[model samples]
Target: MEGLTVKRAYHQHCGLAAAMDVLGERWTLLLVRELLLGPRRYSELLADLPGLGTNLLADRLRFLVARGVVRQCGVGSAQRYAYELTDTGHGLRPVLLELTRWGLFRPELSTVDTVRPRWAFLAVEALAAGRHAEVDEDYEFRVDGEVFHLSVRAGRAHGGLGPAQPPSVVATTDAGTLLVVCAQPTALTEATHAGRLELTGTDSAVRRCTALLTPS
Candidate 1:
């Protein structure tokens, strides 16, 4: 019997290999996904990745920080830490967006879940402002029966409860219709005519929100 020869799997110290080493795990990528949208405290991360255990989460975060993919920063009274991506971390944006575009294409599923792709959210926000300006203001998106509130400050976003303030604009549509609008160049009016989109609220605001969210 011939013995099998295993190739030496060595990744360069300062390349994509190094980058993958930092964010290649299942939960690790999602952690980056969350941060790319904005900063989040430990508990917020837990909520985002409910599948992660405390020990594993801590270890993964430690690995990211050591690789310069993420930075831990100070917060308020509880001294909660928020994580933001470094320059290297920002480079992963394209990769995430590609995956999201792929995910939206599941043929078997009848509709999108409206979970809000982190990369899409981040990309839209980036188009509106520079990296450091993401967390400077709060935002909210409502659809169907749910509302997602973003509490941003200093260019990071937190998903906790937000204050009482009217949204800059409101876009009302079902998850599936919104997904189509965001994935393609289709117009909202057309979607509505096709019986695919039912919406009301501020038309301008909705369009503004959709403009940033849809990749193409």
Candidate 2:
């Protein structure tokens, strides 16, 4: 429990207060964000989340597990354990998506020039959710040097870290390019021609896939 910050409960019979009792702790909801994609090892979580101390991350995981929001399970041939969100934990997706949208679009908020590749993965999902489009395809996005897989199906988006089935389209670009492209409509051909984005697949497929990453 080293580095854990214990806050006094509101001691009131209110749903908001009760939620705070569970999720109000620093980095708790951010942990929910990481788990939304799927299960992850303690080491994987620590590596992806910058600025979070090891002790603090472990304490937060324990707290979420005790609250029934996260569960630990065995993974890989090594028989190591990983943490995944419970159903109740997965239900927080929409809440997290809304928050992401607000953070991205709110004019009053300062713009973020740099972002983690995994965070970009979630940003695409949030934008896809807001699109409400009827499309289904698996896309492999190579941002900077990191690879991310994004799938949009039945008007919803789902994805996680690593490669997946051969993608319908593959886009190679940096996080900044993505943010600019999402904010303003940039032709895929132009981006590709400029050498800022390397695109592969049929022109039509590339176009459709690119739409998935654009902000709504």
Candidate 3:
């Protein structure tokens, strides 16, 4: 807990308070996010969560390890190291998930997914300003993590989802791009025809996919 900090005056050394002590740092939450898939070597960490220096990474790793949030394992004779989440660290998945869902946009997403997912709550708000009233069909939206999925079928927008829900249309754009396309600028058709969007299923499937992203 050497580098850990407590910005909020909550209980200490246990439960939510303890988590905040380490995770309160903006980068720490991202660190948890970078490691969410499982284990990653230091280089991989740098790759996924770029902009973090080795010294800062070492500090975060040590802080996480000290707080029981992560563990380091030695790989082969190369003496390389990989960082992994402990059970406690794994528990932070939902925290980061909720944070992502709640609209956290790093500055890196203006044009590309890049190393960071630059998104904004305003982008989502603009897109979701008005949703189609009654959705009843099965639609898939390959949207980035920051935006919520709303499929308009029989007319009403659908609710939350599980991983089983296959996206009818998959676009490579992050939430920001998705938001931009849905709100203004590009039409789903144009994006698809232009190759920014790669349609997987039939033209009808592509149409249905577009409908999902259609602005309310």
lDDT per residue as tens, model 2, 1-216: 454456668998999899889888878888899888778899999987878999889888888887799999988899699999999998889889878766665322136433666676676777777777788788888888988887788888777777758898887887765655555444444667888888788888877877766554
User: Could you tell which candidate, 1 or 3, scores higher by TM-score?
Assistant: 1
Off by over 4 Å in 3: 1-15, 74-80, 104-190, 202-216
Off by over 4 Å in 1: 1-9, 12-14, 77-79, 108-140, 143-169, 173-216
The backbone clash count of each candidate, in order, is 4, 0, 11
What are the TM-scores, per candidate, against the unseen true structure?
0.57, 0.81, 0.55
lDDT for position 158 in model 2 = 77
By descending TM-score, how would the candidates be arranged? 2, 1, 3
RMSD of each: 8.3, 3.5, 7.6
lDDT of 3 by residue, 40-147 (tens): 798878776767888887778887888788999876788678988999887765455445434533323455445333332223322332344343444434455522
Error of 1 at 190 (Å): 9.7
Which tens-of-lDDT digit does each residue in 1-216 have in candidate 1? 123222233377777775555556668788888876557788888776766898778777877777688898877788777888888887787676556555544332254333443433443334333223433344564545555554445754343233215555444455555565555555555766886555344666555444445444
Candidate 3 or 1, higher lDDT: 1
State how far residue 211 of model 2 sits from its true place (Å): 2.7
Error of 1 at 177 (Å): 6.1
Best-to-worst lDDT order? 2, 1, 3
Which predicted model would earn the best lDDT?
2
